[model samples]
Target chain A: MSSSSSADSRRQFLRQFGLTAAATAVAGPTVALATSPSTMQYDDQKKLGFAIVGLGKFAQQQMMPAFKECKHARITALVSGSPDKARKLAREYGVEEKNIYSYDNFDSIKDNPAVDVVYIVLPPGLHAEYTIRAAKAGKHVLCEKPMANSVADCQKMIEACEKAGKKLMIAYRAQFEPFNLDAIARIKKGELGKLRQITADHGRSVKPTEEPAEAWRVQKKLAGGGSLMDIGIYSLNATRYLTGEEPVEVTAQEFSDKSDPRFKEVEDTIHFTLRFPSGVLASCTSSYSIQEVKRFRAFGDKAWLDLDPATDYYEHHMTIGDKDGKRQPKIKEGNQFAAELDHMAECVLQNKTPKTPGEEGLKDIRLVMAIYEAARTGKRVKV
Target chain B: MSSSSSADSRRQFLRQFGLTAAATAVAGPTVALATSPSTMQYDDQKKLGFAIVGLGKFAQQQMMPAFKECKHARITALVSGSPDKARKLAREYGVEEKNIYSYDNFDSIKDNPAVDVVYIVLPPGLHAEYTIRAAKAGKHVLCEKPMANSVADCQKMIEACEKAGKKLMIAYRAQFEPFNLDAIARIKKGELGKLRQITADHGRSVKPTEEPAEAWRVQKKLAGGGSLMDIGIYSLNATRYLTGEEPVEVTAQEFSDKSDPRFKEVEDTIHFTLRFPSGVLASCTSSYSIQEVKRFRAFGDKAWLDLDPATDYYEHHMTIGDKDGKRQPKIKEGNQFAAELDHMAECVLQNKTPKTPGEEGLKDIRLVMAIYEAARTGKRVKV
Candidate 1:
């Protein structure tokens, strides 16, 4: 709302839009403009030894494989209830047999020198416990997002990390992806014009499964919430990272088919709209009853940025457009998992704050809670 | 909500989805399924004549030229305040100058037997007056969408046409577009599985202008509403057409920079989310402060149909996707304006009700009012 800053922004907008003085000379002046990543080190010693927690599908399929490409991070230990699977992965990753520990013995990892950081890749309900335990065990923590089930839990995890003087980074891999990074950089340059509106939709059909292990995501106690906690968090986090603005208010509506056992404990779909202090509006949807549609699109006054399949483990296609038309800028491909993994390692080495630290994750949890509140009460909830 | 009807739907869903008995037996019986365009004939008659009631940009640029491709409608009269421009267009399009009429004498078209239908292509604020007058003139009426300024006005227009016994069609051109029709058919055939969610976003940049004629759209009285009435209607109407259901409720939010003179009289952006009776959720956005982006995408439990630039006047690209992948099905190109024009002509010739009749338009206006009310009151408004 400052006049001088807006004048600077208007001048920047004019330059980016190819507007000349002659055009502005005849036309009048307009509205006042609304006010609108990381490093690491690994110099001294061996690569940071990360203990893989909860060796689930994401761990075995994405994280462990991604560690092979990481310059400053490597999986040196494993923790899982399935000892046979853990031992196989430990051998595959060249971890000592003693380094493999089950959850019952996980706290004893404090005495082990191999684990420099504990990466918590558990269900939403277990994230806080594991993160806080790992912090108490004197290791830095890299946890998956939706940080935890509740804001209080997330705060406890952050406090545990802070009290122990250890870094707590939420592994928001999208923030580190090269394509998303390019979009963030371009928006900061005023290349996409002043951001006006944003849309984020991420969904996939989820049906009831026979296996209890496979159905934990649909369980309220395990996943914490429903589609919004799992897939919907991507849409919520994208709005924040894309605009770099916290929403002032949220209005949300949810649909849960109670007769469907898959949705009896969790929601099927959650659609929410956000109002930002800068006057940018965002409409987002996260659904468990629909096919996969990962979309993050933002429209500025002059141009727009769109990321189709905006988030996944590996690669995302991004395109930005203007009056001349759309173009997919070629960005050097980088693994999001690897980028985020290495970032945590570097942050620990340099004693620097992680870009998506516990506090950042906590902000999203606050918004998610507000969204659910709005949906439940049928009213707009302030964040 | 009926059990027998739901059984029929489940059977249809299973057959269309290629689901086998084996898959259903293991998954178990689940939630009851959520209870989830057009024609014309013109024979033994000369082509119906259309009198274009506005010589505005849309009329001059898109509609007049599309008449060349129309099979059952042709330009026979002109109505405009500017005589020179109207006469020039009339002559160019092979219309006699005697058929030219201004607003003052527009009602006298009743004596001209050549003008069989009046195509109301004027601004949104003028639709009711012209549609009613055209109906009183004993001519069938084809009014452009966003029917009228208010629900009451739209009701009056519909009643006037019904009282005069003239066919009144709202020109929902997308309904007549072949690609959109293909999407509609595929959805009805269950090719897209059970419809679950809809997303529509349409926006473009607008700047302040000196000319009154050029700036009528940004004026509240002249245009009735801002971007919502002009471009946002595409997103709103698409949700209805794509799902073939009326929204039960609407929650909307608006953002307009009052300091910007262009938005002082009207909103700069309006975002709305709707809930349909069948549990399908829709999120829509319309803006005047951003670059052009037209998108309409629907996701079913099994498949998705997307129409990029869904409501543009001419050719639009469409893609439908399932588990196999996205495919752009080739649909024979059709001119939307001409299609709607000929549709009205055919309805009049056959004495059949038009697919997008006055009642349909009135329904949309009522929803639009609800949307505005929702935005202003910061509450969910039932449609």
Candidate 2:
């Protein structure tokens, strides 16, 4: 086989057997070592360093705390518009003062060897710009979900990363959550029979806060569309990974309370249905006018699996059942963001494509755009 | 107030407090008595007797067993295409030999004093014919859901019953299911804040059985559409009642495995999005190619409510909580089918229109047709 095909085969073998670098490195004697990265084989325990952009509530509260749990990843750099907040967090996280950079000097990170990956936790509008810059800086990129505001921007981010020969991963933390990962593995194993339908919903009530970090979410230019780009991407991405298929057509409806000032520039809620190529269907809902709900239920011919609160950073639980009765699947709870960070670090260290690659991110953004278009036109949009 | 207005006020009051005859007759002075039906006020304990048309598996297995738990309803007669089966069931239920009639002599039920109502449990194509016949024979009608095969047929069933001065109810048992009832009450009380979105899904894997009752479901002329008419109606009706508003527009997608002989004449799956008058959106799915899953989740500004296995006969459960954590609501389980039967009986005895009146049934049928049209043409259909 050609060198590329040989590498692809090894990647497939590892993925199929549910072997991560941590597991394979420990089971070296029994497992084939040809696919194992040289660093892992030699017991090189170097952690891939991440430079988190935008020291917002999500970064400080979720991502920063998650880094403490990550085995193969650590925060080595911090980029923020707020110098005081960035400097303070850097000191607390044990990062050097020279590693902190503002948005204006973000490109200067090319000379910073410590920052091996640029993790963009910025607003949707800034994702493409920072991701491309990170790729150009010879660092891998781990951008947050929704990829970018538009399909063209997502494509640009993907192309820039590819051109620079740098890995690009989208931080779809749900994909790394225990329950969601378990569901995917079981579905692939045909535990639920042939997959037929997926119903996913993710939303939370968004109240206006005094914090500047929350302000950009309600802005159309910064957030892309509305709750859809902010929270609905969870449902959209979950359905794709669960079905393991691309949706061929989409029909959507947008909703917003005209009297509500918060919805003046964005939709409060949007519901959409996706029709996959294999005649499978997925119905999803995303909203900003509701309390938190993250649920994913996949139904197959023989059985069904449900994960209520599916996308939580921790405490994700699941039930595997059919028409007869429900059986609780033993779930191991962990920080999803941490798992995601570790996975990205492994991909970078091993010179392997990310499990959630830029292409996967691009597919979802394209679908998000199609969903918005369908809702606006009141017609089905092919993706 | 005028007599009609006074009657409306009384109906509204009883409905608001969820004072079914079974509850009010037992609660006595603790609950308001002014709204109590006069028939119940006079110490009347007479249970309305029903002549169930179409002695099929559903009627035999579910509705028949449910009658034992009903407070104000009983099976006084049985009408069937098979004389032997009807006579056998009538004998077991302690009905007189003369009370049993084959389809050929179904109109003879008019003369039978035991038959206060005709519950049509036939195939969709037969529902209209039998409902009209029973209405002409001066019996109140409680037809099973989907109302009929066509919108015109649903209208005909309504007019015939109206002309006969008998109550007409469509057996939307999910509305009477305890958990569903609790959700409606909570939403109406603003306990969950302003309702913003509803997501409902109902479906089950339908494999063709040797029984003739299962055969008609796959036949287009008999069952109308496929999954939408049979099971999708639950999601559609739940959305309507939950929002207390009609959907202004609907967009839907259809799916069917053509290789499966069962779907030769109908779609196996359908996903639809309903846009309500107040901008609330409901995304729904109905399928015949999956294991049992009936779930309804309502999201409001303050909180959310979920009913998993929402429309089941016995095992319905619920949880009411928001983003913080789940708070289990004390769900009172009851036989939904029995509750539905009692409601129809009470409506007849009290000279009141059923909550799921013929008009309500007609509205659902219209939307069902709209959904099918949208799915077929791949365009938004106005309801």
Candidate 3:
């Protein structure tokens, strides 16, 4: 490779793995010296090798491009349930044919030192198992959200990474998006004054489609719930982050289309309230049978900070103001997916925990569980 | 008075009340006839006379000035628990000495035709009694809020007015404030999309005082609770008006400094959530031991609207925007108090129901009651 491309590769590798200068100086030469016939060889400053495990639509469209442009990381391996699609993606991305793996041979990847990190972009139910297997293969993992279907599953995933001495990060993209970050920073800085309330909502209209025998998302054993686990988690996370206070109590109500067979085992809509220790109250809602909208607002004694389409799962805007005035059109430009990946890489390389760490995800899941329990029991649940 | 003075007076009166051409035709002749006692027989339309009761701080500052400038309304009478203050205020506001009345003589005013409206600016505990008395006296009534200390009191006030065939309006200034009205209009028009969440907060620091010889505001029996019943009512009303929906269920928590002598019988702070039938959720907070701030925000799919320092009890701003962009500083001009009084006068003169009528007050009081009950019972309360 040209010197410029070589430097770019090193930067990309460092960015992806969050490798600090000290860590790199120690492990860089060692990794280079250990290369053998089957091992991938790289200079101390070369890019870190990464692969996406699920060759699904989201992975093909969004995740692939993200890796391609990452300064410290590169798409060096491809894995998929479909061998044909994996080979196709490898060819299109200029990844080597030998670097491709299928579900059956995923274990063999342990010997492929070419790939250092695995991005698990599978369906919800598959995340825990794939992540744990990737950890056993000595690869750091970036898993798609809801962390896992249950608290036990999430704990298992975390423990697997711990045992492997590898980083495991949950993809909560909104936490890294600038607008949301700015809002959190402003709240921390007391821009809104003493925060007294937070309101968050995530809603969308997603009609049920007839799957060819089995679609993981429509199965309760896979996706957890239709809307709450899918989109409502955003509301829950955003509320906690913006308030900067742990919820002490929760009360929730849920409604489902019992007449609609598509709602079989999941809720179509859910509403919940969280009371924080600071006396701030948060009201949140998530719905799948509604027009799309995502928002977060924090109100204080002097002012307020608000994000419309706050958890857009992508780009959004932020506003800060008080009774006397407001500042808006505060542009938030960039892809949250890229931002989140970048943050995860930095956390891993720098030996720092992510802002939305495993514990945060676990806490959110706990709140979601509490909401479900409250809905079922018709009683307030202590968080 | 000279015809020129009479004409100038009429013009000033029209300007003060914000009367339109239609209102002028209805109220001008009667006011002119009433003021020109020597030259013209008293015409009811010209004699939109009003009495100021309870010459306390708020009445002395806000109501007195408002009455002075009201074109269709004149300060024809005065009533006070303190006779000396009543006589002095009557003199200062140009009321005839004979028109002055004390608490003992208030019933005698029923026989007098000069006063048409009784503006009860009393402490919360006295509102119901005075409002009921005014209704019995064949006078329209504008009662200062918390409407009353209890739901039973509010019902009594409403029944008294209904039985006497007079208009009864609550003094919820925020309902008439232009920016707030604009927010309600925008939300009603679906300018921000479909209402999904509303967050509101109102707070002010409690001033230290030593000579606490039973200040009615700090007394539980008189003020009901602390911040929730006092300032928090504004947040409740604003949330309902902005969403145009009554809350179906509520959950709340309250805090009190048990060790502080001041909080002996009332809450120091409160937080609550309201769930409306449209699946919209409202989170609100009120505190008396914090820096002052008031705000409200409504989020929808397409856009969002916010008012910071929303009910500043003075001035505020409104902002509107969507995920893609925003148009802020939308309606940040004008005095909220002036706007509210203007709207109230227009409502009365135009035979329009006040935006915050007795019913609106009742609903807010009901919600407050539910919140208090929920906090006490540690359970969600249906409204």
Stretches of model 2 off by over 4 angstroms after superposition: A1-45, B1-46, B210-212
The better candidate by DockQ, 2 or 3, is 2
Greater lDDT among 1 and 3 belongs to: 1
- For every candidate, C-alpha RMSD to the true structure in Å: 19.5, 13.9, 11.1
Off by over 4 Å in 1: A1-45, A208-213, B1-45, B208-213
Task: Give model 3's docking category.
Answer: incorrect
Better of 1 and 3 by TM-score: 1
Chain B TM, every candidate: 0.86, 0.86, 0.82
Write candidate 1's Cα lDDT for A1-383 as tens digits: 11123233322322321233223213222222211111112232489999998776678888888988888998877876555666677667777777777655677788888799999987777788788788888999999988988999999999999999999999898899888888888887888888899999998877546433446678676688999999898889888888888999999999888888898888889999888888999999999987778879988998999888688665678888888888898878888888899999999999999999999999999999999999998898987
Q: Report per-candidate DockQ.
A: 0.52, 0.62, 0.15
Worst 10 residues of 3 chain A by lDDT: A27-36
Q: What is the lDDT of residue A261 in candidate 3?
A: 71
Select the stronger candidate by TM-score from 2 and 3.
Answer: 2
Candidate 1: pairs in clash = none
What DockQ class does candidate 1 belong to?
Answer: medium
Candidate 1, position A247, lDDT? 93
